[model samples]
Target chain A: MVEPLRHVTPFWPAFWRGFRALMPLWLGIIPFAVAYAVTARAAGLGVGETQLMSLTVFAGASQFAAAGLFAGGASAWGIVATTFLLNARHVLYGLSLARQVPLTRPERVLAAQFLTDEAYGVTVVHGAREPGGLSFGFLLGAELSLYAVWNAATFAGALAGAVLPDPAALGVGVVFPLAFLGLLVPLLVDRKAVIVALASGLGAWGLSRVLPGGLVVLLAGVGGALLGAVLVTRRGEA
Target chain B: MSVPLVTLLMWLVTYPARLLGLSLGRLKLPPFWLAFLRFVPVSVFAALIVPDVLGSPEWPRRLVGCAVGVGLMWRTRNLALGILGGFGAYWLARLAGL
Candidate 1:
């Protein structure tokens, strides 16, 4: 087991690579964060409330889902239920990181705070490519930068909502999906992946008609995973 | 609790779950669950994106945007470029009265 803090290169190359890896994704975060703030505030949250949600929950999709329900005049319990349902996916992240990194209790606490979708994906991809300890530096850079930008965007959006003309006309809400789609596009490599993507997509659409809140997301994801795994396994047998 | 208090409360509450998972790392997690864990990001993301691409009510325009986005992302492996293609296609179709 490598010590977690062994590599200490105080140099330009590491900084440059880390910056390159993170900046594009971080740049796109501004619109999404701003949208979240505006929408959350619009949904009756004060500026402080909006910032609080982002700072703590930091789960973009769940927050948005919560805000949408809030805006629709859903009960507070309804809002909580929706957010909980949407963020149920984080449980998977907790499990994966647990096996890979034998963290102390304190480290696990920090890991949960830092493990957003982008951060986790980047961390896992780098971990696969190189030793885990060395990759922590890169992961930290990405995660910290995201933390700063996301909070900053939340603040800005809240401020803007207090002053600016309507953001809806510009389709500010759409930016969230656009940003996600950007991330999603890079990962669809193989036939199985494509099939899973399509299946999940269709499943979510069909299920959402009957299911309330974020159950559709959960159902589609589970369905896709089962389908993809079965297809991959059958292919291996052949 | 107030908003900031709620924020702090959530952070504090989730802390235990994180720590528990970490400390229990030594215990063997179920293999099938771990395997499923590997694909959660992509799978969850797809569940979110597909519905958007298909555009809730405007089917034709949304389909076009989704196609363009998926195609560009496939060819360039540039996420930004793919997003631009999809978003631009949507706007263009809207502008052309589609």
Candidate 2:
């Protein structure tokens, strides 16, 4: 093979570019991953199970929700229900990314595997400038780096699980809620979103008094989103 | 269900939803639906976070942690800062028996 300018190792620039793009976000992601593993351990997930979920699901919020629900002894169906809603937005990410970057069928499959919120967001910004930003190489790089970092963090946190003393005494009890709190605040983008959050958050608190906790989350999510949609429509054309 | 089963179930739901998105990307859904979907993350996150905060035995501590977290994250827009700051506040509060 003829060597070209700047082609020594033969790695695609876009791939490394995507990896670098995602590297910065991992600083925010590590604690969340660690918290997940610690919470999972507290929730009675074996180390194997915790690693397996991170390995498979890869979505952070829903994994935390599932761990909380598992600690609360929610049913399997409840876990599935929450996971579905939490991840339903993945479809939108795929749609948006596909619109931005024309991906082949195989590319679609692989990209979907790595199409996390962070990966999607970073790639979107790059896609605007770099032709290869949202390409498969980019996604592979960004997502794989995320995947590796997340799993490694989970493992480290799992070890911390054994090391950290009783959950309540060390104030570890707040980690789960704190983790979700960090995620929630960022999503409050506008008045409509804020209202939806308030409505749903209050709904969850109230429903927790009577309903199962898992069910409350599901109901609040659907009800709040519906309310937001109605408000949007009433205001004007979407 | 067992751990693997639950994980499999989540995967079953997630992958298909994403695949459906790619196929349906060609056809734009109604604008109202799009707006609705956009709000789903906030709604879902609030639902997940609030009940956990309100239902805790150490709610006062949890709320303090949450308030600081929300404030810092909203102000700084830095996730790590928010988490660590809130966590530090929580640990201090817990130690002081708050």
- Top-TM-score candidate index: 1
Evaluated with lDDT, which candidate comes out highest?
2
Report how far residue A185 has shifted in candidate 1, in Å.
3.6
The runs of at least 3 residues in candidate 2 whose Cα sits more than 4 Å from the true structure, single-residue gaps closed, are A1-50, A59-103, A114-146, A157-161, A176-189, A209-215, B1-10
Winning model by DockQ = 2
Q: State iRMS for model 2.
A: 3.9
lDDT of 2 at A88: 77
lDDT tens readout by residue for model 1, A53-98: 8878787777776677667876655565666676665665566566
Candidate 2 yields a Cα-based lDDT of: 0.76
The C-alpha RMSD of each candidate to the native structure, in angstroms, is 3.8, 6.5
lDDT of 2 by residue, B4-47 (tens): 99999988887787777766665667877766765666776688
lDDT (10s digit) by residue, model 2, range A5-24: 33122237778988987775
Positional deviation of residue A127's Cα in model 1 after best superposition, in angstroms: 4.5
Name the runs in model 1 displaced over 4 angstroms: A1-20, A98-104, A125-134, A172-174, A234-238, B1-31
**Tens digit of per-residue lDDT, candidate 1, span B1-98:** 24455445445544444345445556654544444655565677788767765646765666666678778877886767766777688777767877
Which DockQ values do the candidates obtain, in the order shown?
0.46, 0.52
